[model samples]
Target: MAHIRERSLTHPVPELRGHGLLLRPWDAGSDAEVAEWLRGVSDPGFQQWNTPLNPVTDLAGARGSLRARAENAANGLSASFRVTDASSGRTLGHIGVNEIDRTFRVARVGYWTLPEARGRRVATRALVLAAHWALTGLGLHRLELGHALGHDASCHIAEQCGFRAEGTLRGAMFEAGRLDAFRDVHLHGRLATDPAVDLK
Candidate 1:
Protein backbone atom coordinates (compact mmCIF):
# COMPACT_ATOMS: atom_id res chain seq x y z
CA MET A 1 0.00 0.00 0.00
CA ALA A 2 1.20 3.47 -0.85
CA HIS A 3 1.18 6.16 1.81
CA ILE A 4 -0.19 9.52 0.77
CA ARG A 5 0.87 12.69 2.52
CA GLU A 6 -1.79 15.34 2.66
CA ARG A 7 -1.35 19.06 3.00
CA SER A 8 -1.25 20.19 6.60
CA LEU A 9 -2.73 23.26 8.24
CA THR A 10 -0.57 26.32 7.61
CA HIS A 11 -1.53 28.19 10.74
CA PRO A 12 -1.88 27.28 14.41
CA VAL A 13 -5.18 26.21 15.90
CA PRO A 14 -6.95 29.15 17.49
CA GLU A 15 -8.92 29.41 20.68
CA LEU A 16 -12.69 29.34 20.21
CA ARG A 17 -15.25 30.95 22.46
CA GLY A 18 -18.88 29.92 22.86
CA HIS A 19 -21.88 31.04 24.89
CA GLY A 20 -20.51 29.92 28.25
CA LEU A 21 -17.51 27.88 27.24
CA LEU A 22 -14.03 28.29 25.84
CA LEU A 23 -12.34 25.77 23.60
CA ARG A 24 -8.59 25.79 24.06
CA PRO A 25 -5.75 23.48 23.32
CA TRP A 26 -4.91 20.91 25.98
CA ASP A 27 -2.47 22.24 28.56
CA ALA A 28 0.16 19.70 29.32
CA GLY A 29 1.39 21.68 32.29
CA SER A 30 -1.85 22.76 33.90
CA ASP A 31 -2.63 20.74 37.02
CA ALA A 32 -6.32 21.43 36.69
CA GLU A 33 -6.43 20.15 33.12
CA VAL A 34 -4.54 17.00 34.07
CA ALA A 35 -6.80 16.39 37.04
CA GLU A 36 -9.91 16.90 34.91
CA TRP A 37 -8.71 14.48 32.24
CA LEU A 38 -7.82 11.92 34.91
CA ARG A 39 -11.27 12.30 36.44
CA GLY A 40 -13.01 11.95 33.08
CA VAL A 41 -11.11 8.86 31.97
CA SER A 42 -11.83 7.28 35.33
CA ASP A 43 -15.59 7.69 35.03
CA PRO A 44 -17.46 4.51 34.12
CA GLY A 45 -19.73 6.33 31.70
CA PHE A 46 -16.81 7.94 29.89
CA GLN A 47 -14.91 4.67 29.74
CA GLN A 48 -17.93 2.91 28.27
CA TRP A 49 -18.78 5.57 25.70
CA ASN A 50 -15.28 6.63 24.64
CA THR A 51 -13.79 3.14 24.75
CA PRO A 52 -10.32 4.61 25.03
CA LEU A 53 -8.96 1.16 24.13
CA ASN A 54 -6.14 1.76 26.61
CA PRO A 55 -6.54 3.13 30.08
CA VAL A 56 -4.89 6.29 31.42
CA THR A 57 -3.71 5.14 34.84
CA ASP A 58 -2.05 8.18 36.31
CA LEU A 59 -1.26 11.91 35.95
CA ALA A 60 1.91 11.20 33.99
CA GLY A 61 -0.02 9.16 31.42
CA ALA A 62 -2.65 11.88 31.21
CA ARG A 63 -0.03 14.52 30.57
CA GLY A 64 1.58 12.31 27.97
CA SER A 65 -1.80 12.03 26.27
CA LEU A 66 -2.07 15.80 26.07
CA ARG A 67 1.40 16.02 24.61
CA ALA A 68 0.44 13.51 21.97
CA ARG A 69 -2.64 15.54 21.20
CA ALA A 70 -0.42 18.56 20.62
CA GLU A 71 1.80 16.59 18.30
CA ASN A 72 -1.19 15.41 16.29
CA ALA A 73 -2.35 18.97 15.82
CA ALA A 74 1.15 20.06 14.86
CA ASN A 75 1.23 17.34 12.21
CA GLY A 76 -2.25 18.28 11.03
CA LEU A 77 -3.56 14.79 11.69
CA SER A 78 -6.03 16.24 14.24
CA ALA A 79 -7.00 19.28 16.25
CA SER A 80 -8.06 18.70 19.85
CA PHE A 81 -9.23 21.10 22.50
CA ARG A 82 -10.14 21.06 26.14
CA VAL A 83 -13.55 22.55 26.73
CA THR A 84 -13.58 24.83 29.76
CA ASP A 85 -16.04 26.97 31.65
CA ALA A 86 -15.32 30.55 30.66
CA SER A 87 -16.22 31.96 34.03
CA SER A 88 -14.40 29.52 36.29
CA GLY A 89 -11.67 28.21 33.97
CA ARG A 90 -12.58 24.69 34.99
CA THR A 91 -12.30 21.90 32.45
CA LEU A 92 -15.73 20.72 31.35
CA GLY A 93 -14.98 18.31 28.52
CA HIS A 94 -13.14 17.83 25.25
CA ILE A 95 -13.86 17.89 21.51
CA GLY A 96 -11.74 17.30 18.43
CA VAL A 97 -11.58 16.65 14.70
CA ASN A 98 -9.37 13.66 14.08
CA GLU A 99 -8.50 11.32 11.19
CA ILE A 100 -8.15 14.30 8.92
CA ASP A 101 -7.95 13.72 5.19
CA ARG A 102 -6.86 17.03 3.83
CA THR A 103 -7.02 15.84 0.25
CA PHE A 104 -10.69 14.99 0.68
CA ARG A 105 -11.41 17.76 3.18
CA VAL A 106 -12.98 15.39 5.65
CA ALA A 107 -12.42 14.33 9.25
CA ARG A 108 -13.99 12.52 12.19
CA VAL A 109 -15.20 14.41 15.26
CA GLY A 110 -15.27 13.04 18.79
CA TYR A 111 -16.00 14.33 22.27
CA TRP A 112 -16.58 13.40 25.91
CA THR A 113 -17.71 15.41 28.91
CA LEU A 114 -16.69 14.88 32.51
CA PRO A 115 -19.26 13.45 34.93
CA GLU A 116 -19.65 16.79 36.63
CA ALA A 117 -20.29 18.45 33.29
CA ARG A 118 -22.89 16.03 31.93
CA GLY A 119 -26.61 16.98 31.75
CA ARG A 120 -25.69 20.59 31.05
CA ARG A 121 -25.38 20.30 27.26
CA VAL A 122 -21.60 20.82 27.49
CA ALA A 123 -20.79 18.24 24.85
CA THR A 124 -23.33 19.65 22.42
CA ARG A 125 -22.00 23.19 22.69
CA ALA A 126 -18.38 22.07 22.48
CA LEU A 127 -19.12 19.91 19.45
CA VAL A 128 -20.91 22.74 17.67
CA LEU A 129 -18.02 25.09 18.32
CA ALA A 130 -15.44 22.61 17.03
CA ALA A 131 -17.47 21.58 13.98
CA HIS A 132 -18.02 25.17 12.95
CA TRP A 133 -14.28 25.81 13.23
CA ALA A 134 -13.49 22.77 11.15
CA LEU A 135 -15.99 23.60 8.44
CA THR A 136 -15.34 27.30 8.23
CA GLY A 137 -12.02 28.09 9.89
CA LEU A 138 -10.19 25.12 8.47
CA GLY A 139 -12.14 25.00 5.19
CA LEU A 140 -13.00 21.34 5.66
CA HIS A 141 -15.97 20.10 3.67
CA ARG A 142 -17.17 17.17 5.74
CA LEU A 143 -17.18 16.08 9.36
CA GLU A 144 -18.36 12.75 10.74
CA LEU A 145 -19.28 11.52 14.22
CA GLY A 146 -20.24 8.11 15.48
CA HIS A 147 -21.52 6.73 18.71
CA ALA A 148 -22.32 3.32 20.09
CA LEU A 149 -25.85 2.44 19.03
CA GLY A 150 -27.15 2.51 22.58
CA HIS A 151 -25.61 5.86 23.48
CA ASP A 152 -28.62 8.11 23.24
CA ALA A 153 -26.88 11.09 24.80
CA SER A 154 -24.12 11.09 22.19
CA CYS A 155 -26.67 10.73 19.41
CA HIS A 156 -28.58 13.70 20.73
CA ILE A 157 -25.41 15.78 20.90
CA ALA A 158 -24.57 14.89 17.30
CA GLU A 159 -28.05 15.78 16.09
CA GLN A 160 -28.11 19.04 18.01
CA CYS A 161 -24.74 19.90 16.50
CA GLY A 162 -26.28 19.53 12.99
CA PHE A 163 -24.81 16.15 12.13
CA ARG A 164 -27.41 13.93 10.50
CA ALA A 165 -27.61 10.26 11.29
CA GLU A 166 -26.11 8.66 8.22
CA GLY A 167 -26.33 4.99 9.09
CA THR A 168 -24.79 2.25 11.20
CA LEU A 169 -21.63 0.25 10.89
CA ARG A 170 -21.95 -3.29 12.15
CA GLY A 171 -19.30 -4.16 14.69
CA ALA A 172 -17.19 -1.20 13.68
CA MET A 173 -15.98 -0.21 17.13
CA PHE A 174 -13.92 -2.12 19.67
CA GLU A 175 -15.33 -1.79 23.15
CA ALA A 176 -13.09 -2.55 26.08
CA GLY A 177 -13.67 -5.76 28.05
CA ARG A 178 -13.38 -9.00 26.15
CA LEU A 179 -10.60 -9.42 23.68
CA ASP A 180 -11.55 -8.99 19.99
CA ALA A 181 -14.96 -7.70 21.02
CA PHE A 182 -16.56 -5.07 18.81
CA ARG A 183 -19.76 -3.08 19.00
CA ASP A 184 -22.06 -1.57 16.39
CA VAL A 185 -21.77 2.14 15.85
CA HIS A 186 -24.26 4.67 14.52
CA LEU A 187 -22.62 7.10 12.11
CA HIS A 188 -23.55 10.73 11.65
CA GLY A 189 -22.22 13.36 9.26
CA ARG A 190 -22.42 17.02 8.32
CA LEU A 191 -21.42 18.69 5.07
CA ALA A 192 -20.17 22.16 4.34
CA THR A 193 -23.37 22.86 2.45
CA ASP A 194 -25.59 21.82 5.33
CA PRO A 195 -27.25 24.71 7.07
CA ALA A 196 -25.64 25.34 10.43
CA VAL A 197 -28.07 24.87 13.29
CA ASP A 198 -28.07 27.62 15.86
CA LEU A 199 -26.44 26.48 19.07
CA LYS A 200 -27.74 29.37 21.12
Candidate 2:
Protein backbone atom coordinates (compact mmCIF):
# COMPACT_ATOMS: atom_id res chain seq x y z
CA MET A 1 0.00 0.00 0.00
CA ALA A 2 1.21 3.51 -0.81
CA HIS A 3 1.75 5.59 2.32
CA ILE A 4 2.14 9.31 2.96
CA ARG A 5 5.80 10.17 3.55
CA GLU A 6 5.00 12.47 6.44
CA ARG A 7 3.69 10.39 9.35
CA SER A 8 3.96 12.56 12.44
CA LEU A 9 1.25 15.06 13.31
CA THR A 10 1.97 18.75 13.72
CA HIS A 11 2.97 19.90 17.22
CA PRO A 12 -0.04 22.10 17.66
CA VAL A 13 -3.14 20.26 16.56
CA PRO A 14 -5.33 22.32 14.26
CA GLU A 15 -9.00 22.82 15.01
CA LEU A 16 -11.68 21.43 12.68
CA ARG A 17 -14.65 23.74 12.26
CA GLY A 18 -17.79 23.15 10.26
CA HIS A 19 -21.38 21.85 10.44
CA GLY A 20 -22.11 24.25 13.33
CA LEU A 21 -19.47 22.58 15.47
CA LEU A 22 -15.79 22.77 16.33
CA LEU A 23 -13.44 19.86 16.89
CA ARG A 24 -10.58 20.88 19.11
CA PRO A 25 -7.98 19.07 21.17
CA TRP A 26 -8.82 18.40 24.80
CA ASP A 27 -7.22 20.71 27.31
CA ALA A 28 -6.01 19.01 30.46
CA GLY A 29 -5.52 22.19 32.48
CA SER A 30 -9.11 23.36 32.22
CA ASP A 31 -11.21 22.33 35.23
CA ALA A 32 -14.42 22.45 33.24
CA GLU A 33 -12.91 20.27 30.57
CA VAL A 34 -11.83 17.78 33.18
CA ALA A 35 -15.29 17.77 34.73
CA GLU A 36 -16.99 17.13 31.41
CA TRP A 37 -14.51 14.41 30.59
CA LEU A 38 -15.40 12.72 33.84
CA ARG A 39 -19.12 12.94 33.10
CA GLY A 40 -18.65 11.67 29.56
CA VAL A 41 -16.58 8.64 30.50
CA SER A 42 -18.79 7.84 33.46
CA ASP A 43 -21.94 8.01 31.42
CA PRO A 44 -23.92 4.78 31.29
CA GLY A 45 -24.49 5.00 27.54
CA PHE A 46 -20.77 5.47 26.91
CA GLN A 47 -19.91 2.59 29.17
CA GLN A 48 -22.42 0.37 27.39
CA TRP A 49 -20.48 0.66 24.13
CA ASN A 50 -16.89 1.33 25.10
CA THR A 51 -14.53 -0.31 27.55
CA PRO A 52 -11.56 2.04 27.64
CA LEU A 53 -8.18 0.56 28.46
CA ASN A 54 -7.46 3.38 30.90
CA PRO A 55 -10.83 3.86 32.55
CA VAL A 56 -11.73 7.27 34.00
CA THR A 57 -13.92 7.33 37.12
CA ASP A 58 -12.91 10.55 38.87
CA LEU A 59 -11.35 13.94 38.34
CA ALA A 60 -7.81 12.68 38.71
CA GLY A 61 -8.46 9.90 36.24
CA ALA A 62 -10.04 12.34 33.83
CA ARG A 63 -7.01 14.60 33.98
CA GLY A 64 -4.70 11.68 33.41
CA SER A 65 -6.76 10.54 30.45
CA LEU A 66 -6.67 13.97 28.83
CA ARG A 67 -2.93 14.25 29.42
CA ALA A 68 -2.38 10.88 27.86
CA ARG A 69 -4.31 11.98 24.82
CA ALA A 70 -2.07 15.03 24.56
CA GLU A 71 0.99 12.84 24.70
CA ASN A 72 -0.38 10.62 21.98
CA ALA A 73 -1.06 13.60 19.77
CA ALA A 74 2.44 14.93 20.33
CA ASN A 75 3.94 11.59 19.45
CA GLY A 76 1.80 11.37 16.29
CA LEU A 77 0.05 8.22 17.38
CA SER A 78 -3.43 9.72 17.66
CA ALA A 79 -5.51 12.83 17.28
CA SER A 80 -8.38 13.22 19.77
CA PHE A 81 -10.88 16.03 19.67
CA ARG A 82 -13.51 17.56 21.89
CA VAL A 83 -16.68 18.19 19.91
CA THR A 84 -18.26 21.46 20.92
CA ASP A 85 -21.01 23.80 19.83
CA ALA A 86 -19.33 26.51 17.77
CA SER A 87 -21.59 29.33 18.90
CA SER A 88 -22.07 28.37 22.55
CA GLY A 89 -18.67 26.64 22.97
CA ARG A 90 -20.32 23.90 25.04
CA THR A 91 -18.76 20.50 24.80
CA LEU A 92 -21.15 17.98 23.33
CA GLY A 93 -19.02 14.86 22.79
CA HIS A 94 -15.67 13.26 21.96
CA ILE A 95 -14.21 11.86 18.77
CA GLY A 96 -10.78 10.54 17.95
CA VAL A 97 -8.67 9.11 15.19
CA ASN A 98 -6.82 6.53 17.27
CA GLU A 99 -4.08 3.95 16.92
CA ILE A 100 -2.69 5.60 13.84
CA ASP A 101 -0.24 3.48 11.87
CA ARG A 102 2.02 5.75 9.99
CA THR A 103 3.56 3.03 7.90
CA PHE A 104 0.17 2.01 6.56
CA ARG A 105 -1.45 5.44 6.70
CA VAL A 106 -4.44 4.05 8.56
CA ALA A 107 -6.13 4.56 11.91
CA ARG A 108 -9.07 3.48 14.04
CA VAL A 109 -11.83 5.90 14.98
CA GLY A 110 -14.02 6.11 18.08
CA TYR A 111 -16.52 8.57 19.52
CA TRP A 112 -19.27 9.17 22.09
CA THR A 113 -21.84 11.88 22.75
CA LEU A 114 -22.98 13.10 26.15
CA PRO A 115 -26.56 12.50 27.30
CA GLU A 116 -27.63 16.05 26.52
CA ALA A 117 -26.22 15.81 23.01
CA ARG A 118 -27.56 12.38 22.04
CA GLY A 119 -30.68 13.39 20.12
CA ARG A 120 -29.00 16.06 18.01
CA ARG A 121 -26.73 13.96 15.79
CA VAL A 122 -23.67 15.08 17.72
CA ALA A 123 -21.77 11.85 17.17
CA THR A 124 -22.60 11.77 13.50
CA ARG A 125 -21.52 15.34 12.88
CA ALA A 126 -18.35 14.89 14.88
CA LEU A 127 -17.44 11.73 13.00
CA VAL A 128 -17.95 13.49 9.71
CA LEU A 129 -15.62 16.29 10.71
CA ALA A 130 -13.01 13.95 12.13
CA ALA A 131 -13.15 11.62 9.13
CA HIS A 132 -12.45 14.41 6.70
CA TRP A 133 -9.52 15.62 8.72
CA ALA A 134 -8.06 12.16 9.11
CA LEU A 135 -8.27 11.37 5.42
CA THR A 136 -7.37 14.71 3.94
CA GLY A 137 -5.76 16.95 6.54
CA LEU A 138 -3.80 14.14 8.18
CA GLY A 139 -3.09 12.40 4.87
CA LEU A 140 -4.18 9.01 6.08
CA HIS A 141 -5.06 6.37 3.52
CA ARG A 142 -7.91 4.76 5.42
CA LEU A 143 -9.83 5.16 8.64
CA GLU A 144 -11.54 2.29 10.39
CA LEU A 145 -14.45 2.45 12.82
CA GLY A 146 -15.54 -0.51 14.87
CA HIS A 147 -18.47 -0.84 17.22
CA ALA A 148 -19.56 -3.74 19.34
CA LEU A 149 -22.03 -5.90 17.48
CA GLY A 150 -25.65 -4.78 17.70
CA HIS A 151 -24.70 -1.14 18.21
CA ASP A 152 -27.21 0.08 15.68
CA ALA A 153 -26.70 3.76 16.39
CA SER A 154 -22.97 3.55 15.73
CA CYS A 155 -23.58 1.51 12.61
CA HIS A 156 -25.84 4.25 11.33
CA ILE A 157 -23.29 6.94 12.11
CA ALA A 158 -20.50 5.04 10.37
CA GLU A 159 -22.66 4.62 7.31
CA GLN A 160 -23.64 8.26 7.24
CA CYS A 161 -19.97 9.21 7.48
CA GLY A 162 -19.28 7.15 4.36
CA PHE A 163 -17.50 4.38 6.18
CA ARG A 164 -18.56 1.25 4.40
CA ALA A 165 -19.39 -1.83 6.46
CA GLU A 166 -16.35 -4.01 5.92
CA GLY A 167 -16.62 -7.10 8.09
CA THR A 168 -17.10 -8.57 11.53
CA LEU A 169 -14.27 -8.94 14.00
CA ARG A 170 -14.89 -11.84 16.36
CA GLY A 171 -13.69 -11.53 19.92
CA ALA A 172 -12.27 -8.21 18.87
CA MET A 173 -13.12 -6.06 21.82
CA PHE A 174 -13.53 -6.39 25.57
CA GLU A 175 -17.11 -6.83 26.72
CA ALA A 176 -18.69 -3.73 28.28
CA GLY A 177 -17.34 -4.14 31.81
CA ARG A 178 -15.34 -7.30 31.57
CA LEU A 179 -11.81 -7.41 30.24
CA ASP A 180 -11.81 -11.19 30.35
CA ALA A 181 -14.90 -11.43 28.19
CA PHE A 182 -14.88 -10.50 24.51
CA ARG A 183 -17.47 -9.50 21.96
CA ASP A 184 -17.83 -9.26 18.21
CA VAL A 185 -17.24 -5.94 16.45
CA HIS A 186 -18.74 -4.57 13.28
CA LEU A 187 -15.90 -3.01 11.31
CA HIS A 188 -16.32 -0.12 8.91
CA GLY A 189 -13.78 1.61 6.71
CA ARG A 190 -13.48 4.77 4.62
CA LEU A 191 -10.60 5.16 2.22
CA ALA A 192 -9.10 8.40 1.06
CA THR A 193 -10.18 7.57 -2.46
CA ASP A 194 -13.78 7.08 -1.46
CA PRO A 195 -16.33 9.72 -2.32
CA ALA A 196 -16.97 12.33 0.33
CA VAL A 197 -20.08 12.09 2.47
CA ASP A 198 -22.70 14.83 2.41
CA LEU A 199 -23.10 16.71 5.66
CA LYS A 200 -26.66 17.33 6.84
Candidate 3:
Protein backbone atom coordinates (compact mmCIF):
# COMPACT_ATOMS: atom_id res chain seq x y z
CA MET A 1 0.00 0.00 0.00
CA ALA A 2 1.20 3.50 -0.81
CA HIS A 3 2.08 5.60 2.20
CA ILE A 4 -0.35 8.42 2.82
CA ARG A 5 1.65 11.65 2.98
CA GLU A 6 1.53 12.61 6.64
CA ARG A 7 0.89 16.13 7.85
CA SER A 8 2.59 17.89 10.72
CA LEU A 9 0.87 17.73 14.12
CA THR A 10 -0.21 21.07 15.48
CA HIS A 11 1.50 22.52 18.52
CA PRO A 12 -0.78 22.60 21.60
CA VAL A 13 -2.75 19.61 20.48
CA PRO A 14 -6.44 20.28 19.92
CA GLU A 15 -9.12 19.05 22.30
CA LEU A 16 -11.24 16.14 21.11
CA ARG A 17 -14.96 16.01 21.93
CA GLY A 18 -17.18 13.02 21.34
CA HIS A 19 -18.69 9.88 22.81
CA GLY A 20 -19.92 12.07 25.66
CA LEU A 21 -16.30 12.56 26.65
CA LEU A 22 -13.77 15.34 26.31
CA LEU A 23 -10.12 14.61 25.64
CA ARG A 24 -8.14 17.71 26.50
CA PRO A 25 -4.63 18.68 27.54
CA TRP A 26 -3.68 18.54 31.20
CA ASP A 27 -3.96 21.84 33.03
CA ALA A 28 -0.75 22.00 35.01
CA GLY A 29 -1.78 25.05 36.98
CA SER A 30 -5.27 24.09 38.09
CA ASP A 31 -5.37 22.71 41.61
CA ALA A 32 -8.39 20.54 40.87
CA GLU A 33 -6.73 19.13 37.79
CA VAL A 34 -3.51 18.43 39.64
CA ALA A 35 -5.36 16.77 42.50
CA GLU A 36 -7.32 14.56 40.15
CA TRP A 37 -4.12 13.70 38.32
CA LEU A 38 -2.46 12.73 41.56
CA ARG A 39 -5.40 10.61 42.50
CA GLY A 40 -5.44 8.80 39.18
CA VAL A 41 -1.71 8.12 39.08
CA SER A 42 -1.55 7.14 42.70
CA ASP A 43 -4.49 4.80 42.45
CA PRO A 44 -3.65 1.20 43.25
CA GLY A 45 -5.38 0.02 40.08
CA PHE A 46 -3.07 2.17 37.96
CA GLN A 47 -0.01 0.71 39.69
CA GLN A 48 -1.12 -2.83 39.05
CA TRP A 49 -0.29 -3.34 35.37
CA ASN A 50 1.90 -0.32 34.71
CA THR A 51 5.08 1.09 36.17
CA PRO A 52 5.68 4.75 35.41
CA LEU A 53 9.23 5.92 34.92
CA ASN A 54 8.72 8.92 37.18
CA PRO A 55 6.13 7.94 39.74
CA VAL A 56 3.76 10.55 41.16
CA THR A 57 3.31 9.95 44.88
CA ASP A 58 2.23 13.42 45.94
CA LEU A 59 0.75 16.72 44.71
CA ALA A 60 4.14 18.19 43.83
CA GLY A 61 5.10 15.17 41.83
CA ALA A 62 1.74 15.30 40.08
CA ARG A 63 2.32 18.90 39.03
CA GLY A 64 5.78 18.05 37.74
CA SER A 65 4.46 15.06 35.86
CA LEU A 66 1.72 17.14 34.28
CA ARG A 67 4.29 19.74 33.26
CA ALA A 68 6.46 17.11 31.68
CA ARG A 69 3.53 15.83 29.66
CA ALA A 70 2.71 19.35 28.53
CA GLU A 71 6.35 19.79 27.55
CA ASN A 72 6.27 16.59 25.54
CA ALA A 73 3.20 17.83 23.66
CA ALA A 74 4.87 21.18 23.03
CA ASN A 75 7.97 19.43 21.66
CA GLY A 76 5.87 17.31 19.30
CA LEU A 77 7.14 14.16 20.99
CA SER A 78 3.78 13.16 22.48
CA ALA A 79 0.25 14.23 23.36
CA SER A 80 -1.35 13.49 26.73
CA PHE A 81 -4.95 14.29 27.54
CA ARG A 82 -7.17 14.29 30.57
CA VAL A 83 -10.37 12.41 29.93
CA THR A 84 -13.47 14.11 31.27
CA ASP A 85 -17.21 14.18 30.98
CA ALA A 86 -18.20 16.39 28.07
CA SER A 87 -21.14 17.96 29.88
CA SER A 88 -20.26 17.76 33.57
CA GLY A 89 -16.53 18.33 32.98
CA ARG A 90 -15.78 15.79 35.70
CA THR A 91 -12.33 14.22 35.42
CA LEU A 92 -12.73 10.64 34.26
CA GLY A 93 -9.28 9.42 33.29
CA HIS A 94 -6.07 9.96 31.28
CA ILE A 95 -5.06 8.96 27.79
CA GLY A 96 -1.87 9.58 25.86
CA VAL A 97 -0.50 9.11 22.38
CA ASN A 98 3.17 8.83 23.17
CA GLU A 99 6.48 8.05 21.50
CA ILE A 100 5.33 9.77 18.35
CA ASP A 101 7.59 9.26 15.34
CA ARG A 102 6.90 11.90 12.73
CA THR A 103 9.18 10.35 10.16
CA PHE A 104 7.50 6.96 10.51
CA ARG A 105 3.98 8.45 10.96
CA VAL A 106 3.28 6.27 13.97
CA ALA A 107 2.71 6.47 17.72
CA ARG A 108 1.79 4.38 20.76
CA VAL A 109 -1.37 4.98 22.81
CA GLY A 110 -2.06 4.32 26.50
CA TYR A 111 -4.70 5.21 29.07
CA TRP A 112 -6.18 4.66 32.55
CA THR A 113 -9.50 5.54 34.13
CA LEU A 114 -10.13 6.86 37.63
CA PRO A 115 -11.60 4.52 40.23
CA GLU A 116 -14.86 6.44 40.29
CA ALA A 117 -15.02 6.14 36.51
CA ARG A 118 -14.39 2.42 36.41
CA GLY A 119 -17.01 -0.03 35.02
CA ARG A 120 -18.46 2.65 32.77
CA ARG A 121 -16.41 2.12 29.63
CA VAL A 122 -14.66 5.41 30.19
CA ALA A 123 -11.33 4.19 28.87
CA THR A 124 -12.94 2.67 25.83
CA ARG A 125 -14.70 5.89 24.93
CA ALA A 126 -11.56 7.95 25.49
CA LEU A 127 -9.44 5.63 23.38
CA VAL A 128 -11.89 5.77 20.49
CA LEU A 129 -11.84 9.57 20.48
CA ALA A 130 -8.06 9.75 20.85
CA ALA A 131 -7.46 7.15 18.15
CA HIS A 132 -9.64 9.05 15.74
CA TRP A 133 -7.71 12.23 16.35
CA ALA A 134 -4.30 10.55 16.12
CA LEU A 135 -5.14 8.65 12.95
CA THR A 136 -7.15 11.40 11.29
CA GLY A 137 -6.35 14.89 12.54
CA LEU A 138 -2.74 14.11 13.38
CA GLY A 139 -2.45 12.19 10.09
CA LEU A 140 -0.56 9.29 11.56
CA HIS A 141 -0.22 6.19 9.40
CA ARG A 142 -0.61 3.83 12.34
CA LEU A 143 -1.28 3.73 16.07
CA GLU A 144 -0.13 1.03 18.46
CA LEU A 145 -1.48 0.03 21.86
CA GLY A 146 0.23 -2.22 24.33
CA HIS A 147 -0.69 -3.52 27.75
CA ALA A 148 0.94 -5.81 30.27
CA LEU A 149 -0.06 -9.34 29.48
CA GLY A 150 -3.18 -10.26 31.51
CA HIS A 151 -4.55 -6.70 31.42
CA ASP A 152 -7.78 -7.89 29.91
CA ALA A 153 -9.52 -4.53 30.25
CA SER A 154 -6.85 -2.77 28.23
CA CYS A 155 -6.91 -5.48 25.57
CA HIS A 156 -10.67 -5.10 25.30
CA ILE A 157 -10.43 -1.34 25.00
CA ALA A 158 -7.83 -1.63 22.23
CA GLU A 159 -10.05 -3.95 20.26
CA GLN A 160 -13.05 -1.71 20.83
CA CYS A 161 -11.05 1.16 19.35
CA GLY A 162 -10.24 -0.82 16.20
CA PHE A 163 -6.70 -1.71 17.22
CA ARG A 164 -6.05 -5.24 15.99
CA ALA A 165 -4.32 -7.72 18.22
CA GLU A 166 -0.85 -8.20 16.73
CA GLY A 167 1.06 -10.42 19.12
CA THR A 168 2.61 -10.77 22.51
CA LEU A 169 5.81 -8.88 23.21
CA ARG A 170 7.80 -10.87 25.74
CA GLY A 171 9.23 -8.82 28.56
CA ALA A 172 8.40 -5.62 26.74
CA MET A 173 7.77 -3.52 29.82
CA PHE A 174 8.95 -3.25 33.40
CA GLU A 175 6.86 -5.18 35.89
CA ALA A 176 4.76 -3.19 38.31
CA GLY A 177 6.79 -1.76 41.20
CA ARG A 178 9.99 -3.43 40.10
CA LEU A 179 12.44 -2.27 37.46
CA ASP A 180 14.40 -5.49 37.64
CA ALA A 181 11.32 -7.56 36.79
CA PHE A 182 10.03 -7.71 33.23
CA ARG A 183 6.50 -8.37 32.04
CA ASP A 184 5.15 -9.49 28.70
CA VAL A 185 2.98 -7.07 26.73
CA HIS A 186 0.10 -7.65 24.39
CA LEU A 187 0.69 -5.48 21.34
CA HIS A 188 -2.07 -4.16 19.14
CA GLY A 189 -2.02 -1.90 16.08
CA ARG A 190 -4.45 0.07 13.93
CA LEU A 191 -3.84 1.64 10.55
CA ALA A 192 -5.34 4.98 9.58
CA THR A 193 -7.38 3.27 6.91
CA ASP A 194 -8.92 0.73 9.22
CA PRO A 195 -12.67 0.91 9.61
CA ALA A 196 -13.92 2.57 12.75
CA VAL A 197 -15.67 0.58 15.45
CA ASP A 198 -18.87 1.53 17.19
CA LEU A 199 -18.28 3.19 20.51
CA LYS A 200 -21.05 1.19 22.17
Off by over 4 Å in 1: 1-11
Give the per-residue lDDT of model 1 (tens digit) for 1-200.
11112234453567888768888888788887888888878888877766675678899999888888889898889988888898998889888899999999999999888888899999988888888888887799999999988999899889898999999999988775544788999999999999967866
**Candidates 1 and 3 compared by TM-score, better number:** 3
lDDT of 3 by residue, 46-157 (tens): 9998898888899999999999998999998999989989899999999999999989999999999999899999998888888888887788999999999999989988
Residues 1-200, candidate 2: write the lDDT tens digits: 11213233456466888888888889999999999999999999999988988789899999999999999989889988899998999999999999999899999999999999998988888888888888887899999999999999999999998999999999999999888999999999999999978875
Candidate 1's displacement at residue 135, Å, is 0.2
Model 3, backbone clash pairs (residues 3+ apart or across chains), number: 0
All models, RMSD in angstroms: 6.1, 4.3, 4.4
Residue pairs in clash, model 1 = none
For candidate 2, the 10 contiguous residues with the lowest summed lDDT are 1-10
**lDDT of prediction 1:** 0.84
**What is candidate 3's CA lDDT for residue 167?**
99
Best-to-worst lDDT order:
2, 3, 1
